[model samples]
Target: MEGFLQLLLNGTALGSIYALIALGYTMVYGILRLINFAHGDIVMVGAYAGLFTALAVNGPAHPDLFHFFIVLLAAMAVSALLGLFIERFAYRPLRNFPRLNLLITAVGVSLLLENLGQVVFGATPRVFPDIMPSMNWFQFGQVAITNQQVTVFGTSLFLMVVLEWIVLKTKLGRAMRAVSYSHEIASLVGIPTDKIISFTFAVGSALAAAAGILVCISYPKVDPLMGVMIGLKAFVAAVLGGIGSIRGAVVGGFLMGIAESMVVGYGSSTYRDALAFAILILILLFKPAGLFGKYQPEKV
Candidate 1:
């Protein structure tokens, strides 16, 4: 039972990280209708940024929680700016191109970022500081939860809530929704589509950076390729929740997280990812639109 509980805790923590990255994918897809393949690489960038900041700040001395917070903010800011820059340079010009071409370009960008990351950070994995305390937290009957799990769970929930509020209540968010509905219409109505898109990427990337930092806390390492698997999982979560739906993204992330955990807990842990894909297949076979995503017929 303790073993099961341990797996569950780890699974939820992993799921939270997946959901964070997934939110970025879903948000960009929701607003701009672009996949932004490089977004995952941005999360990688955030991990590296935090790792560098941590190492640079306190060296191998293990910074405190306060220091981690500062490093997190710095990573978020850097990733957000890079998100905007990518949108302006890579995506803006290709906005009107064939969707196929745009997807190809997105892949190109993803590869480019990975290569750049390799060049800059090298191909080696760097160990991140264990900034969060490892002390045990409250127990759920027989289940022991650690401070790291609590921090991960709490932080993920807070970010999701803050994001939901921002999307539902803010004026910038209103502009964002308008653009999502119809970019040309939004432009006609005085919404700056470019600015809004850039802002959307900024928000998405910032969330991803936070997720990356959180991931580093648990996983305690960063590498150029770190974002690849996580990115794929996040994309699956985003799709499972409905590609363009924010609430769906959140829902899909946790669901996928739980499903993967269950699969690992009971069956072959190696097949955990296969379980995620299986769920995706089932979702597509029956719903087609995703669990939280609304289906709209294509215009002929």
Candidate 2:
């Protein structure tokens, strides 16, 4: 029972991170119907930004919670700006182009970011500096909880709540919904669709950055190519939860995380990554629209 609880806790923590990343995927897809393949790169950027900020402030020394908070905010800001930059420079001009073109462009941008990151940050993986002092918060039988797990879980949940509120209750949320429903209609209704799209990207990228930092707390490493697999898994999470649905993304992420954790805990860890693809294939075959996704037939 203790072992089961341990796995569950670990799974939930992992799921929280996945959920954060998955939110970015679902948000971008919801608003633009264009899969931003580069979305995962934002996580890489965020992790680096946090690492640099922490090092600059207090090199090698474990930072306090407050210092880590500052680093987190800084990462979010940097990632948000990067998000805006990508949307404006890469995606904005191609708004009216074929979606296939946009998809290709997204792939190009992703590759560009990864290569550029390698050039700038190097191909060697770097150990993320310990931003927060590590300590056990509590232990119950075999289930021990750490401060890092608490922070990751709490922060992720808080962000998810804030995101939900923004998407469901606020004026900006209404605008986003309007645009997502029908860009042409939203534009006709005098909503600034471009601005809305940009805002969506900013928000999503910020979330990705937060996820990056949070994951670093647990995994304690970063690399230029780190986002590639994570981004794929998060994409799978979004699709499984029913792309374009915020709640669905969260649900899918947690499910994926738990499933992965179970596989690692009980079965061969070698097949952990394979599980995501396997789940994706099964979902696509059995329920392409996803568990929570509604099917919409495009008018031809």
C-alpha root-mean-square deviation, candidate 2: 1.0
C-alpha TM-scores of all predictions = 0.95, 0.98
Q: How many angstroms is residue 235 displaced in model 1 relative to the true structure, after the best TM-score fit?
A: 0.7
lDDT values, one for every candidate: 0.85, 0.93
lDDT of 2: 0.93
Model 1 scores what on Cα lDDT? 0.85
Checking candidate 1 for backbone clashes, the offending pairs are: none
Clashes of 1: 0
Error of 1 at 256 (Å): 1.3
Please list the residue runs of candidate 1 whose C-alpha ends up more than 4 Å from where it truly belongs after superposition.
Answer: 1-3, 59-63, 140-142
| Candidate that would win on TM-score | 2
Residue pairs with backbone overlap in model 2:
none
